[model samples]
Target: MFIKECAGYELEKEKSNTSEDFFNRSVVTFIDGSEEKTLHVLYVRYFDEFIQEFTPYQQDPILTKDNIQVTFKDIVALVCLIKNPGLRNRKRLYINSKPEFTSYFQDIDFDKLTDVVLSVKQNNKFELRSPLDYIIQTR
Candidate 1:
């Protein structure tokens, strides 16, 4: 089910021009039969490349129920999930990195991260009434 949903998201991403439509995409999973958690894996692309480039170590792949190996991509995806966009917009937002992967992100330059996030936010803007308004007005 999760794999299928990921495939669907990939298809949508390929067909769309901007990621704004998927900015709020997330997955909810049950924990301990009584608890639930929401994961924003769809935002993994925001940190994928940067993490991959900076980290030389990799975690041992774990096989899922579907027999899929969860590799570095999955690790990065889990780490990058933005639980609260509202809180993230603030001047300082603390994110806890998993102990195993702490070294991978400990050296991140916040200024660069902020610039990247701001750039993504700026580029993703589109008029809600008409998605093509910017394109039309530019001509």
Candidate 2:
């Protein structure tokens, strides 16, 4: 079910130029009867090369999902996700890491996490609400 929706979304991408339109429209129902279809994985191709240059000496790396890896592209999307949770923020919660980190997203707690910024769409602009105020003006 998810695979088909993802495929459809990918196919629609070639026809639509609207940034917000590039998203999966299906919702997932959990065993607890909860429904959610939030932004999950972001595969950024442009920044793949930068992965080799990122040195994680400043702090311990984030705990990623088992068998899951964080690439440079993921980091780039994460940076954007933190800056503007609304940039194609079709997904309910995007960790750039994995969807299982619900605690991290709900708490908005960043003890040793780098590039951790909470953002939202305010007045049609990307308003940074943590660490510092990094205003991103959108057209």
Candidate whose TM-score is highest: 1
Judged by lDDT, which candidate is best?
Answer: 1
- TM per prediction: 0.30, 0.26
Off by over 4 Å in 2: 1-37, 40-46, 51-70, 92-139
- Across residues 1-139, which tens digit of lDDT does each residue of candidate 1 receive? 0111111132145455665543323332212223333343334233333444455443333223344443333333222322222321233222233343344344444333333233323342111222122121322
Rate residue 1 of model 1 by lDDT: 9
Computed on alpha carbons, the lDDT of every model, listed in order, comes to: 0.31, 0.29
Model 2 scores worst on lDDT over the 10 consecutive residues at 1-10
